[model samples]
Target: MRDVAQPAVAAPAYVVGSGRNATLSPGEIGSFLKFDPDGSGGLKPRVDVPTAQAVVDKDLSSTEAEPKDATFSFAGDAATVVPAVTGRTIDYQKTFAGLLDALGKQGDPTPPTTFTPPPVPPGGTRADPPPATGRAVNAVYTTTPPKVTTEALQAIGPATVIGEFQTTGFAADSGQNIKRVADQVNGATVKPGDTFSLNDFTGPREAAQGYVEAGIIEDGVPDRGVGGGISQFSTTLYNATYFAGLDEVEHKEHSYYISRYPAGREATVFDGVIDLKFRNDGTTPILIRTLWTPSSIKVQILGQKRYDVTSQTGNRTNPVPAGVKSLAGNPKCKPSKGVDGFTITDTRVLKDVKTGQTTSEPRTVRYNPEPQITC
Candidate 1:
């Protein structure tokens, strides 16, 4: 026995690298060996089949796993991307084959062995790391990003109707004014946290502004004014924006109730003296759309949906009861329509379905019955 030489033995296991050098223990690697298709090891003096496979599997799993992808979220005014994670897993059969090759070549002083790492999966985007200040950022992975993104919003494409109102009764000249005013308000864009004004956008109503003489309600009587019929446009816009959950900066009800309007929710604009104003107290921008037919005027608002608004109108009170009066002999005198006088209030409630939040706004209007008169 003095001259006999002992056979060489392979190392029990090998170390593998992962994200930031995370190590897999031999015990964990040992569990995966039975799944190897090829018998563990071929040489009698080398590491066993299970041990060799365990080493390979652990290394492959560590370096080849794929990461989870990122996603977007909107909370109030801030747009954010939730961060993603990285994952890895190796090619089982090939890596295991490499391990078999290493086991066959093992010797008394077994040196560490390595196989070429598997190719990385295509570079996928995960949410970027939180900013140094730990604030969320709006970053995305694809060319077609989320619709609510700032870049996507910058172009502001055709809007989706969020709220709308329409009326089908109009006189020709009044209809012209309605069309002209609606044209002025159409395509108007309101930035986040900004205010929109009917008078400002429509400019002064004069002959030069294309305003024609139309019948308008003035001091409880129907009078002719250059921008007379524009009140219908104002009323339409008021209801649209009102339902869209905007804040009314200034609005006034008509002195006399017009049967066509939605009770107390209407507004009247008289160039500089009276104007319809509302604030876009929202996290995103909004668009105004106006449409006018031969006998109809419609107004609509467009923006990202946030709040759900519903309106309720109280029953009419103080009905003067009479309905129209006829007056003669005064050609220049304005006519009065004797509709019943009444008082009513409208309540608009806004509910934030996402956050379970709510707010309410109310408006009360009193209309004096304008005795119908003939010129």
Candidate 2:
């Protein structure tokens, strides 16, 4: 038989030598001169020496994938791959901690995807989470310089004109309203030496202003009046002042016994008519605070007291016996008519704040019930 012919399998080899077709060893990367774009293996001196060296060095370095210095080195046992990637020395502890924490959450539940249609609707529906249910901290801050809100008044009010409070009552306005305007006025400050007006703290009460006319029993019949039932206001104030042991400079008794006010010690008031007044009776500015409860109105006269007192008020109705002849400033008094009346007496337990001394005393005031005639 003739000699069997062997087919050749061509595996490329690199040559490193002075020849234009120099084949290189494993240490050498490519042909010495230049890459032939035409696939011919012959070297062409097209590139300059500098550019040729750069390309040659890049290939040479790339071929040695593992650095010779890294072989068999245990000195940097704790170092990481790409240690200088962050442009700073690695905090190995923190880096591992973060990595471990991430791995720990590998099984953590993903936040459920919500199909919110563009802008989400308010108020949680069945599909939504329960309106961010949690024990959240609530904080109140003034949004616009503590503005007076109609919503606040609307939400808190349309108050029952208790026989003890008026439009100037704290219930009718916000604390900011009272405190802000009071700060603007001068002689309005009620120091130990000065007397204060309720009107002073609340600014002015006027007809063409914010106040609405209310019906009040004037003389005997219910008449439309401004600041009517303000005497009830006076009563609340008196109760506070009396309790605080402040000396009252000027005050009055109502024309009739008002069930809500402190008895005899209370002062009555009517617009352009009767007025009730009091003093600070302390060394500091006395701020008046008022609060209304379900059954009663509360007034707080806050100040460093000259004395302390247990001021108590009780009501006693002295009904005009079917017919009491009226003579005090009323010509329209019905003498021969079925009528009723009452009286309220206020008692105070006085105590000296400076000395811490205490005592009980009675404040005398008289409210003449107007005769309601059912003739």
Candidate 3:
């Protein structure tokens, strides 16, 4: 019994990653076994679950990997699919059970053969019995599947440019902030019936996240603050969502209108305080892609086309004249020209391609007058 168990004691058990050969050894198979006296006064080998689990934790824990979902990469007008990766984790309970079963067989004696060997011909030598080989338990592994697979992404069909918008004419610092926010928003995929929030996705936009101090509106006045130009990204994304015929969950317009953006169709976002969000109402997933230049930024929404969308803006009305403020001695004062504020309405028209049905949705926005700064 000892001799039979000796070979099994030194047998190596393996834990392996997916699609790879077994390279990690969870020590010897007999490390989980202990000799104890049976009730009949005979020694018996038993498996220690804790010892087996310890060996797995030490050797197999490090082999775990996180799964990655498939995504799209765009170049110019073309998009390519990036394959998903499978994740691996050790199954401690299952592995311990396998070790215990293998140990039981290792301690058992081989049964006698019942069949007789064939008679050898005259002057022919008989063949010797084959050498016995010990078997070891292989550690079990569990696989975690990625949420988005390549086939699943491909089944959504080829992507079409459903909505696109661009905004330009920004200073260097402001352009940097715009680009930073754009980088965070690019390549985002919104599944069907799922809502995407700009603030939630980008988190806090502070200096640590590469945002710089630029121009912004504070209490209806121009001021310098971190992540100032992020509103341009929010406005761009908002317009794209508008053209995509998606559901606008939440959005807030700027306090004052900037000539660079449409009067009543722009959006602003402040971390935690304000957010820009939209829901994917279509049946397929939508992918957001961003492109930026030195003084300009563009956002594009790509997915299956479901609507033909158009927009109309009403004439600005209820104009309010600007007021003047003198800040000659203030070091933080930045001189700027005053602009009149007004109210305007913007309408989005959507025509369903499948049914040839049309729907019109209108939104009204009001802006505060910009105060003249005298320095």
Candidate 4:
């Protein structure tokens, strides 16, 4: 019989997405098929399920995204809801099954007729392989919804101003630091029974994070450091937490009293050392809203009004006189008049709105006299 010729067959290929976005292909996902000779003389296609699945997982990883919950954005005294984002993930099993089914429908190739071999010329090569061929099957995907949807947040309740406090009279540099920290803290939400930490939320206070050198108390003396004026924010937040009837998890009083802050109620923070933390003790989530101006900063807590809170500051006691300090030759020295140190107590009286019950929490703070400095 005369020699017979066999037509070239192409491997199957799969693709996801469409148009310009269609960079994903079957070869990228995994090598799913291998050809084996049938006893009758034709080639049989077999799919490696495990290998294909592994490749699918590795290839689709970049396509996966985490869902984001909805939250509120506060401007002035009004609040607006931010919509949640839906996430997407590929359905590996469905995609693989669909691809396999598509390939099966194309059917196996017919066996080539028997033929006599042809001799190749010396130093010559056989013809180049045929170009790759395959069918492009679309991938299946599933969407993930956010846990806290905008509708759910709105159904909770209206954001009532439960606590609010404002502080003023900071210099320009200190004011910048204060505003930077305030921006980071603005519109934070604390879920019920969850504690919010200033350090944990804002991370490190470095220049890279947008904090600048400003006035700060270093070792009971006036100095300048990055994020110096943020303590004013801490003091303001502490007062807001106190008036909101939230549980104070951790807070520390300033080493020396600043005239602008409430004597016994003020708080100070140092990164990695001192921190301002508070727990949302109520049933509903609380939103922290911060606002700042050129000379002032304000913090407000918005949530259910569970308690009517008030403060009573007692008289200062245990007076300690400030001593004089001379830093005549030091370029970094800052001069100031000394102030007497004393101990004082701030009592928070909480009255339950529903039960009409009342409770008192007393917090005492001691200040170390600020020494008079001479540069």
Distance (Å) between predicted and true CA of 154, model 4?
Answer: 3.5
lDDT winner, 2 or 3: 3
Model 3 alpha-carbon miss at residue 351, Å:
1.0
**What TM-score does model 2 achieve against the real structure?**
0.42
User: On residues 1-375, what C-alpha lDDT tens digit does candidate 3 reach at each position?
Assistant: 654356445444443322222321324455666778888988876667776666556645655567767777768656667777666666666655545444434332433222222564422222322322233344455778776676556655777678999988888999999989898877678889999999999999999999999987664446899998898889999999899889989999988788989888999999999999999998988888889999889898988889999998999899998898787877767788888889999999999989999999999998988888888
lDDT of 1 by residue, 1-375 (tens): 111111112223333333222222335333443322346653222234455445444433434434543322336423344333344334334333444333233242332323333444333322321211111111111222222233333433333556778887889998888888887766576888788888887778899988888886554445777877878888888989988888889988888777788888888777689988999887777767677899888787776766789998999987776565554555556664467788898999999868979888878788876666666
TM-score of each: 0.55, 0.42, 0.66, 0.65
2 or 4, greater by TM-score: 4
Q: Please report, as a residue range, the 10-residue window in candidate 1 with the lowest summed lDDT.
A: 131-140
Per-candidate clash tally: 17, 21, 0, 1
Superior by lDDT: candidate 2 or candidate 4: 4
Residue 36 of model 4 has an lDDT of 73
- How well is each residue in 293-358 modelled by candidate 2, as lDDT tens digits? 323455554334356456576765554543444444554433334335555556777766567776
Clashing pairs for predicted structure model 4, backbone only: 13-134
Question: How much lDDT does each candidate structure score?
Answer: 0.61, 0.39, 0.74, 0.73
Q: What is the lDDT for 325 in model 3?
A: 75
